[model samples]
Target: MKNTSAVILFAAMLASLVSCKTGGKALLPNVSGKAGEVAVVIDKENWEGSLGTEVKGLLARDCEYLPQREPLYSLVNVSPSAFADLFKYHRNIVMFNIAPDVEKQEIVYRTDVWAKTQCLIQINASCADSASVLLERNGENIAEAIEQAERNRVIINTLQYEETKLGDEIAKMIGGRIHIPVGYNFKKVTDNFIWIADEKQYSTQGIFVYRCPAEDEDPFTLEKIVARRNEVLKNNVPGMFENTYMTTSEYVVPGVRFLKYKGRDFVETRGLWEVKNDFMGGPFVSHSFYSKDGKEIIVLEAWVYAAKFDKRQFMRQTESFLYSFEWDKE
Candidate 1:
């Protein structure tokens, strides 16, 4: 199997280069493999030992807001020699190099080393004990790096597959640009709000964009945001029932956090949503930021309704839309 994968990898690399040259422009290969997939290159013995357990615990941590306990990432363990041409281009990778002569443990991160839209994290340590210690200390950071790599992959993939007409229309209305993949359509559009969704047989993923009046007293506070969310859903998102509409689920309290990305600060909210008087419900995430003019609060929300299967990948795929947001300077 390892030899076969290596052969396929070489063929793909050759094909990509040839195609790029023929096309008159350099085109990096699209990210290969599924979202949230990670490749770990380590010796077989170490991978099957205590270090392997630690690696799995950290990288495969359970995801939240899902019906069943699904791993945060699906890790593929490959021996050092098997990390060849094609495998080198995995979207996310962690390589462990253990040597007795090495004195200190260090982690090196690189991007696009072997292919486009890839992240490689290398951990160097002197011995097994040192490597285990380093892993224990930096487990969280490593996991985050892997996760961020996938997020970046999503952004790049979205841009590559964007629907220009839909993107332009949304940009004009929202005063900014977002990568709306071709399959997504404008479900509802109003002066102050937009609802875009990718409807599938078993699930529906969506992105919601809206602006609300920005006030001095932290308009993005949890209390204020939830209040505004209910108002927006009630007005724009209607359910099948006579008096039903979408709103945050009261059964499970939502979580709020602050994060800084691409020089912008945003308040992020995560929770479940249910139709007020209907049985339909799912998970939703929103990122709120103040517009450049400071006149309104711009919030980008991504939600998923996949009742029949695990939702970790679905949520991650939709969440990438929020990160791809960029304000168009007027």
Candidate 2:
């Protein structure tokens, strides 16, 4: 009877939490932590034990494109009891609950439970052994979910910024619009290509917009996309020296996947790009989708060049703009 009552109380508490909504407090920007940072709620003993190591390896592993060490997400571990109001409102959070009596291991995800535009992933495990097995099986899914949530937050924040003058300009040129935040300029514009960039002292973030005729045959295959990208960059994106131009790096093959965002279907690609005959290179991410009319294939890409600092934040900031892609209403 006592156990049943306890469970009932817990359910009621969770229900209350989900029901209670804030006016505008929770919708505001997450000011508690930096971009790509996650708050981890777990017990200290477990955090210091093997479980801790496993969790760190999965979430805090090194992010690509940084010269020095930089984790994919900077993790701030907090004991379950110490998870206070500040941590509750963070943008990204992961909590683990372990119990010997737990029937099975499971992962639960919730959004806006405590605050708006927040993602919380909780893992319940029967024991340490179960926890290990569960993490090994579902670690990738958890990581991907966290990343998607972060991207969503970025889109929301950008919209709130309301820097639509550049977006409107791009919409006029490309027949579509994407949120372009302040501090970016139209570096170059041509018939088939456009370059917008936010140039900084030690880092440079930019976006490339271009389009081509949509052939009846699918032109989005990996081979076709790479060929198109190479050709576009070669002609429009030049380098510091003669015969030198930006091209996709042959050293590391680009990763490609299909996804649907905001009613638009896109083939997303992530890869390194290099300047031929030059020593400059960095990472690039692109979204290739067909225009609303189905007559043209548009590619919106964000790339980063930050030699002295961590690239994760820079990449996140620029890539967020890609998610802002929206079709203009006629």
Best by lDDT: 1
Candidate 2 lDDT score at position 39 = 92
TM per candidate:
0.86, 0.86
Over 124-241, each residue of candidate 2 has an lDDT whose tens digit, in order, gives: 7766678888899999899988888888877887787767777877788788888987788888887778888889888899899999889848888888899999999999988989
The clash count for each model shown is 0, 0
Candidate-wise lDDT, in order: 0.82, 0.81
Model 2 lDDT, full chain set: 0.81
Clashing pairs in 1: none
List, residue by residue over 261-330, the lDDT tens digit for candidate 1.
Answer: 8998999999889999899988889999888878888889999989897899889989988888887776
